[model samples]
Target: MLFLFFCPGSFGADTDEVFVMEGDSVSLTCLKKNQQDRIKWYYNDIRIAQMNGDPSKTCTDVQCNEGTERFRDRLKLDHLTGSLTITNIRDTDAGEYKLLITRGNSDSEKIFSVSVHDKVFVMEGDSVSLTGLKKNQQDRIKWYYNDIRIAQMNGDPSKTCTDVQCNEGTERFRDRLKLDHLTGSLTITNIRDTDAGEYKLLITRGNSDSEKIFSVSVTGVPAAEQDEVKRKTVKEGESVTLDLDVKRNPNDVMTWHFNDILIAEITEDQSQICTDFQCENGEERFRDRLELDHQTGSLTIMNTRNTDSGEYKLKINSISRRRRRSVSSEKRFDVTVTASGLSSGAVAGIVVVLLVSALTAVGVGVIYHRHRSPRKAVEEKQRASVESPNKEKEIFLQTQIEIT
Candidate 1:
């Protein structure tokens, strides 16, 4: 970096901008038509250090010995004039540094100051989540991706800005990620492993900055499989299907077992035997009596009898190795064989006894009513006489004779 130092009284220069870098070596050159070589360097308005005055004796001795030990050997000077070179600058060097030159009663001086800056990235999640941001709303913090500004700090709810293509479109987020500008927190639901990457954050308050970084994580749930067993109590020779309702991935192969025995390998298709039952033991009593309901995953028992009562178990197998077999609950169906014609006879006997008792109660009510009504019979005779048409005509004739 090049730096030129001149005084306000000097006629040889324009452009008052002075560039100073912290912790870096800097040289300020003052060009002159001729040189008397009276040079001095000052910090702020105070005279802190100066070079050994000489005209042609090689380089002058550095005067950094006048300041603190931190600036030792960090300062150098040319033998010509008031040009000052500061090497290995520090924060203490941020104050104004001035150089004054006098060559034949002509004088010049230049003063300037400097500051050093550093960038710090602070990110919270594997994905984009702005959690625990101090003054997230009005703070003028610039956002960057690979050091490129996509948007500026504007604390308005109507302002909506996000990556449309981050991790293959925002559609995958689907209510999973909640971006709240008011709180400056990005919450992600059902986060998967693919959402891990590098992120950067740059906070600025008139060039004063600080940052934080954090990692987000997710947990996994174990794989599960289930079996379904159904049982029914059917009358002898009654056809009833026991359905198995199962919820599992297609990678699992569902199976069934009846009466503690597997299904035998058979060539016939149209039988009560379920197709999915694999027979390993011969104890299966309903060998051919059990049939598979192909449409629904159920075992149909055709002509079920009293002998088919027992505990039944349903087994499920997984075609994929990643899944494990889980059996359904044990189902018990008690079969009681009703004697031939016994139920019908009992029903018929109940009907007959009910009808006879009803008729006897009604007859007794009629007889009792007649015996309890002697006064009713006399009232009936009087009512019959008064209501006769002949009696009415005689009464009307009497009334006519009286009126005449």
Candidate 2:
């Protein structure tokens, strides 16, 4: 069990509230301990663990008569400090826990409240909805991002405010926030990298109140950083490959998204490669045209079409050597697929041939007019002379007959 001591808090005189994400381990500490002390841990008044100094005396869950089987083998007890640790915590584990320490008939109690929040992941420019409100519940809802109030709604007067309106002229969320009038669910549109943070929703009903926290993480780079993205142009029916530019690690998880939709993924030391509908629940737009390079994590799109033209984002999640933590980085490519399968040089050659053909036809028409005009004039002159000779003879015969 990997213990994350950061999620737990130190022992306090008052009730200590600890917040953690699901699937994490947390330790509720009881610092004040004595060798002869008898420590017992309970969840919502039900005894779950009891230890009497010795490590062998530690008993948990079914081993104790009053304990329940829900925890099973997931609990660990510290014999010296009397601190309780729970591993692989589920959402059902969120509740109040009490610790009773009996030191020679003097009983002391400590309280620890655990709350499990959800982790939400999204890409830039996508919209995310934070929904934890009960339907038709007439409660006042307030939303806070990074501990700053950004939106709120009241049921009595049906009043609501968001962003600047909630802060009396502050900016930040601005027009991106949408509050549901019925459920008070908040939706943020056109999410940016700066929008990634903790969001808390507080629901108040008379004297009782409840809260839900969501950790939002934006994966890809923001659209405003287009200069960092590589641009590629390919003719239809051609293939284009987007290179990762870095050597692939064995533990790296590579996912490719087109227009914010998952299209391909490579995982498990490159043993698992999926594309289109296989990667997620969506339209199979790629249709077996995608290929993954096992060595470099590069993506190749074969027989590209105009529909493939869009923003392609690659996210790589790998473990960092220095920090020993999972870190992710994104690379984007703006692909443009032309409808015509003609290269630029081929199109230029076609234009040159059409221009030469047009010039040749115009020159041939000018030459034909110049050559035919003189021949047409000579033929007309010959026909006029042939008719003039016959007319002169007829005139002379008519004059002689008149004189006689």
Candidate 3:
């Protein structure tokens, strides 16, 4: 027999938290059962912004000389639903935010907590541990790599696999992982270049759940002799050259891929440039612009356009005449090109405009969702609760009308 208990101050309210990539925009809504007369927002217990329904007035504390400088120009209010929109969010902007809505004779309060971290870098061949910081909660723990379950800790005492069992798990991390049952921490040993990606830990206690994310970046891979990231800024219509310092043999196959799409291939002692099995000179985008250095397998673009800025990868299959075997090597380069007349300020302005436009579009969609149907809102809420990474706690707000 199992029993579930709902604690005091936990009922009649819903708490939601969100994690976003750096520089991304986010929207936080204090969902209510009925429209309120006024909504006020607070950050870390300090009142920040307020919106009144009767006068149609919405202003931040900055407008009345009472708000902090942190949210001066980045916060906006959705008057209809009492949702808050944050733009160009940074790591420093992460913290606890509260919302207070005034109804006919009562005031309702809601809180939201946000946390942000860009990435975590670990050296290859070293070990790393991802921690979930709940001290007293004993529950089921599941760890995922790119959304695929890697390891799980079953709460059942009679179960065979209580802690870490990767043999039946994914092949990529079968023998290289360990999980701490008490702390809900996952440890990866002998980390390789392929293990550099996103990792998530989902913890479920009773009906409450929360998740933490870790973006692992493995370094110190010495397979190649070049920098992982090379920076080169060029003006529009200028020429650029990307080189692969691999010696090509007479029958070795050297291929160049642009943005993950195959562009050109060299075979027959580097004399032929073919798109596929057929021997051809150039493709639609390269035209007469590509020149190959046969000796070193270097590619030079004669006239570069703005569209040429992206990732350029090189793959070479070096055939060994003596051993009758081949060895393959891969290299990539990220290129960035700028217009000749655009200044730094102009570029920043363009980025801001694009982000603002994106936020506005998302706001319109949220408003449509709120006005369209309550059933839709409830459905979306359930979906969000199931999928939300930081949904370990649930807050239930008292509704004006009870659903029978």
As a TM-score, model 2 comes out at 0.55
Candidate 1: stretches off by over 4 Å: 1-23, 32-35, 52-70, 113-404
Whichever of 2 and 3 has more TM-score, that candidate is 2
- What would the per-residue lDDT of candidate 1 be over residues 1-404, giving only the tens digit for each residue? 43445544543434344444434566665554245556666666555455434434323233334444435566666655445677765434545666666667777665555332211122221122433344444554433333333223445534444444232234434555554455433444334554433223345555566432223333332332111222245566666665545444444333454455554222223343334333444454665676754444456667667666665544433232321112111223333433234456688999999999999999999888766555555455456568996765665555455434
Error of 1 at 319 (Å): 58
lDDT of model 1 at residue 279? 49
- Name the lDDT of candidate 3: 0.66
- lDDT per residue for candidate 2 within 1-404, as digits (tens), equals 34433224444467877888867888887655889999999999999999985767679987877999988799998777888999987656778989888889788778888987666776686566777745456688889998888888886554578888775425887698888787677888778889999988899888888887778888775445544447888889899999856689978888889999988888874446788888766467888898888888899999999999999988776643432234355667899998875778899999999999999999999888777766665555566557797755665454444334
Ranking the candidates on lDDT from highest down gives 2, 3, 1
lDDT of 2: 0.78
The stretch of ten residues in a row with the least summed lDDT in candidate 2 is 319-328
Q: How close to the true structure is residue 72 of candidate 2, measured as C-alpha lDDT?
A: 72
lDDT of each: 0.47, 0.78, 0.66
